[model samples]
Target chain A: MKWKLLFELFVVFFKIGPISFGGGYAMIPLIEREIIDKKKWIRSEEVSEVFAIAGTAPGAIAVNAAIFIGYRLAGFLGALAAMIGVLLPTTAIVMLLGSLYFLFKDNALVEGAFLGIRAAVVGLITYAGIKVARTSIIDKPTFILFFLILLSLLFLHLNPILAIFIGALAGILTMTAKKKIQQKREEKTHFQNKQIREISK
Target chain B: MILINLSLLFLFIGVISFGGGFAMIPVIEAEVTKRGWLTTSEYTDIIAVAGMAPGSIASNSATLVGYHVAGVPGAIVSSIAITFPSLILILLIAVSFNKINQSPLFHSIFYGLRPIVTGLILFAAIKFAISNGLIASTFSWQMVILLSIFALSLFVLLYYKAHPVLVILASGIVGAVIFS
Candidate 1:
């Protein structure tokens, strides 16, 4: 059973490493289908938590998913194996391709091929952004914040790191304000109930 | 000494690269070009090679650059370093995700990040489009055909949910027929 578990982790991640197109974001749905629905290795709630963690933390979402899934399946060693499995195919391909890169380095055909890929890649990135925005930007404040960041990056030529920092700060403040309001409402209700009990006594 | 520094330079590419391979370019250019390890044109060529390679562009480029700067050891270190940030962060997140979910503060941080990430993705798209010669190239009839192919691919992707590989393959065929 242990061996089977290890092999399953290896095979699933190895297959995922190569075929995953559109970089990190697109792999989520496929991972969801395979790991959660089909394999039942993890539940949906856990998948959501993993998604949040993977996106919020650094690195590629796909790699994070591999770590999470591998850790769930096995342990620390499983995470190591899963990382190795996920990286192996891409590494082998890159190393081999890198060696021969200069040979066809200027081949117009290869250039044309990449031109096509770049176009599609652009579309994929745009699609991904739209999807993420649709899911996350629900409220008016968030909607405004999204457009403001876009304008700052486009017209003002502001640095992205600064923009992200500012945005994160805004979110923290907004949530804190909401929390304070809720706390006040709760306190008021408690005070009223105490006064009523005192009057009755 | 310079070569050793170059290895460390590529190591930074691995660490901060979020939003995918494209996001690393500005950061990479700043560090590598500033240090004179690679000229702008050489860096562009490397990017081209990265685009053609089958693996993740950032990883592949880091390995190739590492090899060019030093040797096999450079490649190993750069590759490991580039991937390390993601691996370690994910491991930590995996351990803490369940507990973190209960925190509203965590929720708000993510809520703030969503829009910013979207903005970053859009910025990346614009940058890639310009770099790939999509924007500056003359608007010829060839471009018309290319746009048609792009629109068709987009429609198929949105309306029909056609597999991305097929869309990409078809775009390649269309580009060859028209551009060639």
Candidate 2:
């Protein structure tokens, strides 16, 4: 049973590893389907939690998820198995593809294929951008921040890192203000309720 | 000497890569271009290949850059080295996830990072768009078709929840048909 579990970890991450085009987030649905939904290796809610952990936890999210999932399934050994399985395919493929790519360096068809790939990649990146915005930008402040950032980037051609730094500072301030407001409201409620309780007693 | 240099270079890449592979672009570009390790076109070709290949773009890009610089050994060393820091950081953080998952301060930090990441993606997208003719002076029917494809793909992705791979394949077919 242990060996079979290890095999399952190996096979699942191995399958996801090479086939994960468009990087970390792009593989989310596929990984969710295979591991959580179909295989029942993990629960749907667990997968979402894993994704959240993966994002904030560091490393590549996909690799992190594989390691966690593997650990969940078969413990430490399973994690090693899964990580190796996932990375092996990509390493092997990159080695082969990189070597062979130079052979067709002058081929126009290859050029065209890459050109098409580039255009498609732009679409993919743009789609990812919109999805990110919808999920992250909720309140008016955040929305306005996003719009201003977009305008600054699109027209002013400001550096993104600077914009991000500004946004981070804004977030800190907003969160601090919101926390203070909530604390004050709670205090006011407590005081009023205390007065009311005294009168009743 | 060469292997050591390559490994160290990739290790640096892994550590500083806060926003993943695409964000590593300018840094890697600077290194390769300044060093004359690869031509500009070669670097762009590598970017395209990394985009198509599996795994993290940063890892894959590291692999390609390494391969071009020093062949198979270079690829191995660089990929492993570049991925090492994040891998270690994640493993350590994974152990503490349950304890720290609900911190407001943590959420706020991410909220801060998200817009920055969005800005980076936006900047990258615009650069790609211009390079690929998303905004151009030339107005061919092909341009119109490409724009429509891009617009439709974004719509499907945002509204219809279409899978990225499917969208990519569809775009490829459309490109082959129209461009050919």
Candidate 3:
């Protein structure tokens, strides 16, 4: 029974692996359909929670998600099976393509194809930038933060690790300050209401 | 030596790659260039291929870089190295997911980190454009072709919401026909 379940896990993820282009986000809906809707492996809400956790965790979102889902279903071994299954197709495909690219890299025809592909890649990356920006740059502070980071990266050539660290620190400091101010305001309002009630009494 | 370095480098990248594969590109570019494994344009080619291929772009690129550096065994090592951190992290998170998710501080950090990630991705876009000659010092026919391709790709992705694989394939066809 255990082996059958493991095999099923492998097969399911292996099937989902190849068609999951455009990164992990693209694979989420398909994973949901197969795991939640079709297989009844987990609830839709649970899947969403998994996604949130996956987003926050380090590594590829897809791999983290697969591990969470697999662990939820059948513990560590199941997680390994799911991860291996999902990774296999892409690994094979990439290895094959990578080898081919190396072999023909100097070919004029191949070079031409890459040139065109590279141009289109610019568009793809730009679209990704805009998509994330739309959701993340929601207000003035975030907008300023965004441009500040951009300038640091573009001109100052800041190390990405340093940038990420600075961003996290700024986030913690600003958010904590905001929360403290909010608490003070609430306390003051509460004190005023209490005084009014005592006077009326 | 190369394998060890590649493994260690990818392992570090995997650990710090917060906003998914796109956010990792600049870091990967920095490392690969610094190591003298590939030139900037060559690395961009890997990025293009990685974008077109399956799985995570970071992993795919790692595998390609490993392969470039040492061969199939090198590829395996680098891929494993890149993936290892996430596996360990996810397992830890799975055990304590409730505690982690309930923290307001966690949410706050992400709120700040998200916009920074957005900026990093945009930087990647600009870097690729400049390196690939999409944004040139002087305008020419090649620039026109590139801009048209860029506009067409952006429109298709935004308006029609076409799958990225299809967009990449279409771009490759356009490249083969016109640029050739």
On lDDT, the leading prediction is 3
Which pairs clash (backbone N, Cα, C closer than 3 Å) in model 3? Answer: none
| RMSD for each of the candidates | 5.1, 4.6, 2.0
Candidate 1 docking category?
Answer: acceptable
Task: Write the residue-wise lDDT of candidate 3 on B1-180 in tens digits.
Answer: 888899999999888888788888888888888879998899888888888788888898999999988999988898889988887888898888889888888878877888888988889889988998888899899888888888899899999998887888888888878877
Q: After superposition, how far is residue A51 of candidate 2 from its true place, in Å?
A: 2.9
TM-score of each: 0.74, 0.76, 0.94
Q: List the residue pairs that clash in candidate 1.
A: B14-B82
Interface root-mean-square deviation, each candidate: 3.6, 3.3, 1.2
Q: Identify the runs in model 1 with alpha carbons over 4 angstroms from their true place.
A: A1-12, A23-56, A97-102, A178-201, B1-75, B136-146
Q: Write the per-residue lDDT of candidate 2 for residues A48-137, one digit (tens) a residue.
A: 777776676435677777877777777778777887778889988877777777777566656555556566667767765665666677
Q: What are the candidates' individual DockQ scores?
A: 0.42, 0.45, 0.76
Give the best candidate by DockQ.
3
Tell me the lDDT of model 3 at B107.
Answer: 76
Model 1 C-alpha lDDT per residue in residues B1-180, reported as the tens digit of each score: 745675566555555565556555545644666777776445655654554454466776777777667766766677777777777777776777677778888788767767776777666566655665556667766455545655676677777877666766676666655555
Per-candidate Cα lDDT values, in order, are 0.68, 0.72, 0.85
